[model samples]
Target: MAQIPSPYWPKGVPRALCLPQVPLTHYLQVAAERFPNKPAVIFCGSTLSYAALLARVEALAGYLTQRLGVQHGDRVLLMSQNCPQYMAAYYGIMRAGAVVVPVNAMCTREEIRYYMQDSGARVAMVAQELLPQVMPLLQSGEGDALQAVLVHAYSEGLPAQPASDEVPDVVLAPRQWADAPGLHGLEDAIAQALPAPADHPGSHDLCVLPYTSGTTGHPKGCMHTHATVLASNMASQVWRGLHMDSVFLAVAPLFHMLGMQGGLNVPVTLGATVVMMPRWHAAAAARLIEHHRVSTWAAPPAMLIDFFSNPAASERDLSSLTVLSGGGAAMPETVANLLQTRFGIAYNEAYGMTETASFLLGNPLARGKRQCLGVVTPGVDARIVDPQTLRELPVGEVGELVARGAQLMRGYWRNEQANQSSFFELDGQTFFRTGDLASVDEEGYFFMRDRLKRMVNVSGFKVWPAEVENTLYEHPAVHEACIIAVPDAKRGENVMALLVLKPDFKGQVSEQDIIDWSRERMAVYKTPRIVRFMDSLPKSGTGKILWRQLQEQEHARLATSPAQEIP
Candidate 1:
């Protein structure tokens, strides 16, 4: 049960890791000192060097502390697309001794409001493109808790107008913040601001607060300190053999843990350049990869599917690409085979979550299997265990995969009940229960078989059924709602809503009507793709919706019939 990893490990890679002990911002500090002139981020056609980037971060840090009255341990909200402003604000929040809470930029007003109210974030640095969704929360006079808001225009931080059509229209278009009150210009503030006085936060000081869609509740914040978050970033750089010359194409959304760790944090830690993209377009990605000679890119498998299938990518110079990696969903065998035969590149697969900061297990860069997640990283202790019994299983046995490592989060923020369920004690050590059912092979390679939770993963996005069902309950025409995951051809899974309409609206409200209403109320990723009207749901005497019974029934029917239904 205590077996080590397979012999198929990277030749020069270490089995254990020792990371930088300073604050997360220290990576930027050291990078500036070592490679001041090297580009820290390349957005559009222009570049922001390490020295300039660090200066901007410190300037904004000063503004948060000196001008905005942000204090240590206080939370500051950040909502934006992948761009240069994200980098500056992320580090600036930490450098000022405040915690950074990054939320998905695509979240609806109802969802974003919950994040703001739940995190107790009074101050925020948001992109101008997303200001309309956040404008309603600016009133501190009401019960709204917002104090100060800093708005940054994506184009203002760019060197010039981006020529590529891949950039999001919101970022490409000029911002209209002319008459908006309480919306201070962040770019302008940093331009005229001075560096803040040194405020040294301890290694254990809380830094990043990333939200995760829990198994049974709304999104809960995973509290991570500077030390805990740094472990994965350092390990990624070491595991991938990244250096100053390595160029990471930032296609993954930075708001997520995987992107924050590998796409942005790993590259910045080593003074390497990150090619930031505000939006994902396969053709545009091809142009940038060819033009910049990008060496490494980590994104979702969906992006890779589009990139390789698109003929536009073939026109570009992909000779510089050496490492292509991602994790949300498994890469198809065909894509992996093509990468191996044509590009001589391995699609490095890894496993991680917001609670783990990033990669807990990864395929070796040199040696890897088509669909296997490689050995556990340097300092992690992982094993397959019986989900209900908590007993470690023998090799190749199906069980719940659990991990204990430095990359683990401190715990869920302020929710002791949630923390109690998420972690358990074993052998005098505490380990986080991943709640994902997986198995370890004789060779020590991990394989994911299924999940124990009712959550849905749509193209790497976590869609909580409870969250979606709660939203549907607010609909006037919906009497009862239950969300389930169905097989999807493109995405790994698609959200399906099974509902029993109210007597008054049985024929009045259509399925399309419910779907359309949801799109306006929640994030598109969390919206239900298919809606099924049932005569009545299988419920208990207490009137509790029997979600699992319906889910299992659907699974049994789909298993017997290969032909699947879709939106």
Candidate 2:
């Protein structure tokens, strides 16, 4: 089927983009050549010019190739919070003709090990603060291919004396580490200035492998090539009207696809300045925006809520902001109204997944709808189809959303079964199943209704219940566990675990005990906020847990009860 022309498409924007067929590093090289002195990254008042950033990227690429023997198509794991070192490491890995496997900094030791082993990463670059989580993996002498670890401190990105009181204390501390065999400091790697091997990766070569959790309880990696990543990078730059002068506030985690594209990749592609934040602190964010004159920010609803709630936000001069957009969960209508009526800024909500580079559908800046996922972006063909029959649904009918576009990943890395289930042929075009239930309106805007996948949206983070349930099963007292989503006033939804304790340990294990156990075993966002003990859990004839049934009963119970503290 031909692309459906949406009447709601942004005016004057092309229906299709003529993207350059080259490696992603080409953009960085071009920017460095054109604007050598321009500030490429700004962190805690410290600036890294285009020339300096590119030089560091080249040096790190050389270290990976020469010292670590990272060859073409090799996967290099990168684990860090948002910082300047992350930017260099990301581009450097790709520059060395290796694929970047970015893991969340909050990942537990086991979670980090899984990503390193699954991606077959021979080398990893981690943040200094997160070294404790990664050191065990290197010392375990496991059969995993991991050979070298390079660590960088977040403080390396901060100025000697913080430019403002808003800078986090963690970012002010100096790097402290005991040298170990096969462990290298990031500064030492850059100082080597070893010549990088020739860049051989083309547009079609794999560049990134970002993992996404599934109902099967294991995370699957999405294989994105330079071409696929560039498609979204260029599309977002054009769609959002970002340019060389735009100063973007980077608060979203770079490991996630949205932040990787909006906060890092797009800004680098345009040679725009990026004000990097180590973590999301409302007061710090407000201060940075005012001081740096940040013009664009791609933040989730949770951050937006926090920003407006902070008393400092009202006093700060955010008049420099021109674009405010993001999507993980829908923006609350009340908060959206506050942004428009008070600040004169529209929150342009977008929809995409790890499978798609970052953007597929986004609310047009000039004509955005409240809580809507906007229209299909350029070069994308999106449709709604019945989940069971796979038949196309009519407009305004809720169904699974699917799309085929240049920005879509090649496929799930090394998971043929997942790849087969995720993509299907319809009218001679292969469309990736989004696993989201949504409907398109007459004006071509899409509205999300629900999710077909067993996932929870806590703030902006995705928590797969199966993954959390798997972690809970590791508890000594848990006999069986079922995780469900509960409504949260602040964070759209939070995880709630319904657990059946073992007969011998039933009276011994408290709800708080189980919650404490889970925190150490998984990412914080995936930790169950509420826990309930159960004598027995309902199951199907095959003894499969009836999670959906329990979820419905819980929602029904909440509907009738008066509001009470959830904890």
Candidate 3:
């Protein structure tokens, strides 16, 4: 493979620091050596030291291998929230040389079924509340590939104080094979197993199989190796200047890459204590920050919005929060500034996908930039490519952003066609097309413009929908808005803005008011001509506004409209 281009590498990332030869096992082993007595994880009022966490990982690894007959490369699905046990199960599977497939805990039965069948995961550790979602699939003879089910209590069974739960018999149905019990209690199994030595997973070994919905339309398993995970963690830590003893708040879902890599794995790599929460609640998060004295907190823009808006915001003491990072989606400028000015926390932003193993680029928390997705980190290369010509674009020119790095996925699991199209060779260097349209400034700061798929052609001029929507958001009346291209006879496509007004606004705001608002701010050709008010807009499971779906729905409505009859 050709070496990464020099211009793409971020400044200050020392080229002298060599990538580690040992895998994730090295991370855990180092933690045991350095911060053995420090709290590695804090889940549900219980804290686990690094040494104790390692002991549990070893015991669980033994149970999975010796008792359950799990072998090398055997896929084990982990479906749970952000908890200590979940981490134990994930690392345990990896330590046993088994591949870990983490499924989104909030996915519907159909969605879970697709991942379960696709990964061919023979074993699954399911949270008790989610048993209903996975039970039907497991019992319907559809997920026959699965060999065993391990039931885990999300709120129970810490090392010292175990939470109480009345284990329900009906929670699980018996399987055909009597020897393979359908529901194996995780606590019981871990309690019985003797601590075994941790197996050293090699760099080439597949560690995590994180499912991501790519631009290709469906979700696919992004095959992340031990090297990719470790490299990504190292890059993020170095770029962010995260301290080893820092306390991080784990509010993002562990199933997602942002939460898994940024919120969870990054802290573990530094031997830091992670304050865990199964789900995000603004008041609870603030309390945790005050109670745990969490030094760092990373979440989506919505989470911050909720935190600042909460009634408890005035009462909570959030002085410990020094680094407030945002991912999964863009942070609103107002919200970003409020967190910085009011809370005295720097807003750190990251830009990446599951394919890049969480973050390829991030701003340092100490001197973080809230707007742009900061410069590229070390061990990675980035370039802008022309969307149409498939040629490299100049640094300041707008084009699709592509990345090449040691952190890139091994490939989409079992999908050769996708793997082929995902990466392109330019001047003997392999670059993954990110599908996001962006540009780099003279200072190497990257700015996202819009999604190529989201670009709308109004008459002949290309109108970026995000620009229109972003401008509309600035309007006092408009709380949320989306712009789409609607078919028209006069113009090939007319710009239509869908908007939701602020709930407390007393004065009436017409569609023309929004159009006039945009007309003043933007160019005549770029302004939205058509406008429609909505009570609410549809959103994806990940909290992303589904603009394409909204556009399609508008088109469908217009296509089937009845013709007016002349009197």
* Candidate number of the best TM-score: 3
Per residue, candidate 3 scores C-alpha lDDT tens digits across 1-567 of: 222233544456664346787768668768978988999887666788889888888888888888778888888989887778888888888888889899887788888778878887878887777777877766776535466677776545443333212212222223222223466777777888665544577888998999986655678899999888877888877776688878999877888877888666888888888988766667777777888899887777656765786778769998887677766556666666666687766678888888988878766444445457766777677778897776887768889988888889989999888888778888887889888888877767777778878787766888877667667767877766788888877567778898877776525988888888888999987788888899888765444677888998999998899632211
What's the best-to-worst order under lDDT? 2, 1, 3
Per-residue accuracy of model 1 over 329-385 as CA lDDT, tens digit each: 556565667777877777888888889997788888776775666788878888888
lDDT of 2 by residue, 30-123 (tens): 9999999999999887899999999999999999999999899999999987889999999999999999998987789999989988899979
Q: For each candidate, give its TM-score against the true structure.
A: 0.81, 0.82, 0.88
Q: RMSD (Cα, Å) of candidate 3?
A: 4.6
- Sorted by TM-score (best first), the order is 3, 2, 1
- The deviation in Å at residue 355 for candidate 2 is 0.6
> Which of the two, 2 or 3, has more lDDT?
2
Which ranges in model 2 have alpha carbons more than 4 Å from their true place?
1-4, 454-567
Best by lDDT: 2
Greater TM-score among 2 and 3 belongs to 3
For model 1, how many clashes?
Answer: 0
lDDT for model 1: 0.81
Model 1 per-residue lDDT at 56: 92
